[model samples]
Target: QKDGTKERYVYACTPDGTVGRCNKISIRCSEVDEEAWKYVKELMKDQNKVEERLAEIEKKLTSNPVDVTPIDNQIAEIERQQRNCAKAMVTAKDDEYMSQLFQQEAHELAKARREAEKLRADVLRGMDDFQLVRSKLDEFRKRWLDHKTKLEEEPTYTDKRLACSILGLKATLYSAGHLPRYKFTITPPEIEFLILLHRAERQPRPWCVSVPAG
Candidate 1:
């Protein structure tokens, strides 16, 4: 909302006579990073015996051989620690321990996937919002086409199902090149939310169009 073409700016002018904006900040995930890295190192330690040896040998053949002093010390350290794992295996209740480990692993994987999914949804939502306010015509056109095609090819619906599902408003099923291309199913169990969105562009209320029954 600039007044009569008065200047508008995202960032304030800098001392060097240039507009400036800060780079996006990425929040620190130190704890998660450390935990993931530690797990990776532990897993690699178990599997790196032959792989590490081969890599070293290959590097030596192609470039230069690594100094043996440090390599020998690392090998000695690994050999010394190998018995710790062996001792754990020997003293463990294998079945119970493994079952608990498997459950924990699955729980962690699911938690990670959920967290990632939320992040993805957030980013997509943000993009949709930003686009709504400041999208190019080309971008909108492309998405409109995609949505229209999606509608033709797949209309997830039943009687009285509301129209207009929004995909970040990036795409709309009403646009060109996409209309009911094929049949798609709408299942009753798919109603995960009470409020439904659809692909039709009617007013934000239910329409009263007469259904012609055969």
Candidate 2:
């Protein structure tokens, strides 16, 4: 079958994506696969995406991009809502009504401030989680690539699954290998899990990797 003979092979691409290739051959020696060109082409398509990303990076380079504008927006909305409360106070013309109005407005402002602060904290936490996830995904990708490379050196091996797994792109791998069986493949519910996880109040002292023995 090596001498220009055709053979059938199934390729599981993305989740719910598939392709079949027969008698594929390469005439040139290459550093990366032909498919890698597609990735490069994808990156080349949009100048706007590049410029937008640059702007986002510049925003991050500034000191503390998070601003009080969200809080300001909430304050404005609350003030509008409390106008009726203010009018009520004016009509009553009693010290008790004035005190009540002040307390109500104070509570509304406090609630808005708290909500904005919580959202800001959540965004910060999400950025940290993204970094952690990228690191972990990189580790997985490296290991998957190494394993796939070893497999390639053998007499027979298909790189279909390996390429996808290398870059955190293996959802279809599970689907192909008897979908009903491995259907429950894991996905990162990072935000949901992080919400449940409470940070330890006390900082744990750093421990040396090895303990010196007497």
Q: What would you estimate as the lDDT of candidate 1?
A: 0.31
lDDT of 1 by residue, 89-194 (tens): 4555467776566556556555654665566565465445333322322232244333433322322222112221111111111111323211122222121121
CA lDDT, every model vs. true structure:
0.31, 0.37
Q: Put down candidate 2 lDDT per residue, 149-199, tens digits, no spaces.
A: 332232211222222222222121122223221111222223333222212
On TM-score, the leading prediction is 2
- What lDDT does model 2 reach? 0.37
Best by lDDT: 2
Question: What TM-score would every model get versus the actual structure?
Answer: 0.21, 0.33
Model 1 regions more than 4 Å off: 1-94, 135-214
Residue-pair clash count for candidate 2: 0
TM-score of 2: 0.33
**Per-model C-alpha RMSD:** 27.7, 18.7
